[model samples]
Target: MNAGRDAQAAATERALARAHGLANAFLASLAERAVSRAPSPDEMAAALDEPLPETGSDPAAVVDEWFERAERGITASPGPRFFGFVTGGVTPAALAGDWLASAIDQNAGLWASSPAAAQTELVVLRWLKELFGLPVEWAGALTSGATMANLVGLIAARQWAGRRLGFDAAAEGLAGHSPIVVVASTEIHLSAVKCLGTLGLGRKQVRKASAPGGSVDIAALATLLRDIDGPVIIVGNAAEVNSGHFDDIAALADLRDSHPGGAWLHVDGAFGLFASASPRLAHLTRGIERADSVASDAHKWLNVPYDSGFAFVRDGAILREAFAASGAYVVGSGGWDPFTHVPEMSRRFRGLAAWCALKAFGREGYRALVERCVDHAAAFARWVEATPDVELMNPAPLNIVCFRIVREGCGKAATDELNRLAVRAIQEDGRAFVTGTIWNGQAAIRAAFDNWQTTLDDVAMLQAAVKDVATSLTP
Candidate 1:
């Protein structure tokens, strides 16, 4: 072998070994690590910023130095007590699969380029559909995250809507076409609004569908749909962010039927759709199968690594027409070409980790994981109500607990301030991590239990931290 090749191979082995050791150490320390310890931006920059060297350095040494610096800034999100958002911890199998994907370096953009990537992705998509109780035949693609997934689904909807209006929106653009009415509840996720903006359907043009407490008022939606004269797109929520309440999707599906212009039903199922994985929680996503398109995040509840999303469309032909690229260099393929269904042409091999995870855990394993998180949230809500100093802001419909601090004889403003202080204090205490939010116009602390590692002891620790902080801040 050439001397250069021999040296490179040895370097690669050493670098990989260093990475593996660092990963193991991090995972092992999660039990005792603080959920968060954010380093100041200036400090982090000082640690990581340096001028590029003219000469090559030892790859293994560089890896070790990077790990040491990066470890200081990492949030213990994979730990049991992390409740900041609907973030899921990576499973061992998923992490291992991710490593394999990088080692293989497969560009999963074209079917001909990597047949294994395409077929494995197809299998993973099928498994997800079955897990979520969606139709197995639905066309789906894995994207970077829910945002991209929502954009892909909305692109298809825009085209479908344009066709109903006797125009090809993809080719002709939205200039001469009749305005497509994008209807959404006020509770719809911000990502949906972003999707509309990205699709050139002005976000301001979205017709507000009045839904109180995250439940779509079917009669209100019907009246709005009845009056709409143009192509329609209705966005529904599988799980509302603050309360985790699910909209009546079946009712939304019925309204789509009687509309003047057949409405496109799209569900933003971000973290909530995982509820369907649990038999006890599946009722929340009832009639989700009726949606014309669905957008969800695998990174959130699937416990996969960052940046994995799913976009599913009932009409495969329409999805392909909306996104499929054509050029002399892009060869025709009988196999599944991912670029045909998704927005990206150069895609990462994200499906491998998701596939490994689903295969490792199976259906029953996921059910237990999801159900346990929901149960934890429910228990935390109960504890909040039982504790006189704290009050539940909303019913724990799924896996999010929103609560506020209450002080005897304190005014509303004072109480809100105390709750705000409590949140900040608890976060700084470094025992557990939770986020602050406003629920029903009141300042509140939100703990979303989605991490599979979280246990009852972790929940107790969170309760204690909040109680201590709130009591200390009380007047």
Candidate 2:
């Protein structure tokens, strides 16, 4: 019986190895293909129709069949042209690290369970803090994504604010506490509001401060704060998702100094915080260090795989108090456990990929890549400006360029329709995909340069494709 079990284990490992090889090959090919393509409904249904086996089957055969069927259904978000969202293409080092992480199968929840995993996380966090110019003493936790990071950051903010008001909100809950006011710019990400609501703070409890050019107007924010009663938590954006516009962090920090007892300031820099790596763009995020807490995503700009986000706090004690839970079954010592700092238990070794990527690229390598993307975006913007038929929509502040198709005689609605039709045509006919977005109440095409593979030649190709599609759409 022991021999038979050993043989089965060997077979399973072989099958898993084969499956991993196939997945890697598929992902590599996808990186070279168009970013967006959906399989037909019939193909999806057929893939889902396979019956579950009642008896044991060859694992290699099962994995092969599934991969063959599902390959067509996968969207190439990891490809260079996928610009619909602020998604980052995984770096080669990070992808390899992810594969190794899965093979290791380590749960990095506590130091006692997996000391290596915990140490790796600690090293990565320290490296990140140095790279991003954060305080050396700041504590951070790896989370699933920006949503969870924001949630965790805001939880600490709420706790700190409540404590100042002489209420133990974290311990006793918000039962009899005065309503807390959460302030954010009108351009604040919707996830912030969702997080507040999840914490039992009503959506109406959030006050919207007017912003111009996708940043919070500091004067407007101060005026609103003056009238608000009770404790407040001010949420600021490091980067606006739509236009890549950065808020004036220095000015906001100055405002924070004036209101010492009134509010707590948290910076939500999901994608924008990474800009600090680029000397050219670092000025845009000036004064970010003054923030009480910051939340950012590695998946967005660090080129790590999905589900890698982080929340950093200047006050580690507050973070621990906000999230730590004790249980009889769980062993506890005077050691660090990740669950004490974030909203997760049984977490995977997600920080491994990030550590690998950071180590492999080093700080200078990443800074060069970020600066290249910014330059490419500027070039694309210049190309659009040079072309009479293409009108630049917003300032190319980072790696994103927003523009629209414009003709001499076309009306606004007609121009919008033409741009939409052009996007669809380019996706379908040219096998090059780009997406459209509404910018400042006008329809525009947005192309974000995030992938390392993207270059000036690729930008020229995209420009040509746009022109071809627009010409074809002309009546």
Candidate 3:
């Protein structure tokens, strides 16, 4: 038995070493590698899928085979020129911390299981709050990503709305809370709506106020609030996904405070909240501090490893009231358990990556990163502006540039097809990757600049690739 155990331990060590080598090899090749490849379905299954083995295989062999078989199949979003979906590349410090977290394998659900994990999260939370100028008294916890963050923020908002209506929403279903309206601008992220639906608020309960230039029309929103007599939760978009336009958060907070029936203000600041890091761009997220609950993703702007975000609620008790799981074994010691604040109980030590990211890149470093990305976006926008074939669809306020291809005499349908073909052609060329979106009833290209590795040179490459793809397009 001792001999078998020793052999297994050796295999594990070898497997880990192999992983390290493969990881570094991939990172070194990212600069010159293709941005993405369409993985062949049959090939993928043949490589990754297999019948269950009665016995076990060599650990190192398994790792080696998987790495070799799946390398080209993986999307190289970490590459500098692969601009799509507001994705961020993993920073060195964050990658190291993530590896360490996996090695530690701590369950951060309860403080008893991992005091270090809990403390690390607490430290990270403090740093993030201070960076965003949020009140220190606010309660928060790390989550899987922006989706879960939205859920947490909306859950607290639901509980707060329930209290105002004299009901315990978590204990009792949302019965008789007819039309608990969720008022948001047209620019609200879909995650917020999904969270509302998850919390028993129907999707129809969402009443969208008019938003001009992707920012909430405060007057129209106030009018909508006055029309609604029931409980309300107002959601603000810190950064509109397509245009990177910021809603007037201060005005939204003012409306929330002034509403006759109190409104729980939640801000979805997935990548946009990082604007607060830069002194010059702080005004974009000016009133974020006043939001009742705020959700943001570290993976988007902090350049941390995947699966890291946080949701902060102004009131601790309300947050606890939303997701306070209980059990005989879950005796959360040391007066605090991460599970009390969020939905998950079996949680990974995600704080490790975030804590290391914040430490490695202090406030100044983050500011520089944000400024650089914003500048890159502006540069790309300038290219679009100068090119006659490309029409700049939206203002490049922060980092996203929405543009579309133009045909002199083509109708809407032909123009849309042209835009689609152009996007597909560019993607297939694979010099740079960008996603297509339908902007204001027309097809357009959305280039989101978020990765820390992306430089001015990468932006230039994207511009060249786009122009080449456009010029190569046949009538």
lDDT of each: 0.88, 0.82, 0.88
Model 2: worst 10 consecutive residues (lDDT sum): 30-39
Going through the candidates in the order shown, the clash numbers are 0, 0, 0
- Model 3 TM-score is 0.97
lDDT per residue (tens digit) for residues 44-88 in model 1:
898899889889878889888888887768888888888987788
Clashing pairs in 2: none
Off by more than 4 A, model 1: none
The CA lDDT at 144 in model 1 is 90
RMSD (Cα, Å) for all candidates, in order, is 1.5, 2.3, 1.5
lDDT of each residue in 1-475, candidate 2, tens digit only: 6999998898889798888898778677764665555556887898767677789778888788777777666667776666656777888999889989988899999888888888888888899889899998998888888888899889999888778778867788987877777888988887878899988777767888887878899899988888876667889998877778888988887777677456678899998898899888899899999998899988878889988999899899988888868888789855678888887788999889999999999999889988988888899889988986888888989877888888888888888888887777776653446778777777888887777667676777788877787667872
TM-score: model 1 vs. ground truth: 0.97
| Residue 74, model 1: Cα distance from true site in angstroms | 0.5
Q: Per-residue lDDT for 408 in model 2?
A: 87
- Per-residue lDDT, model 3, residue 342, is 89
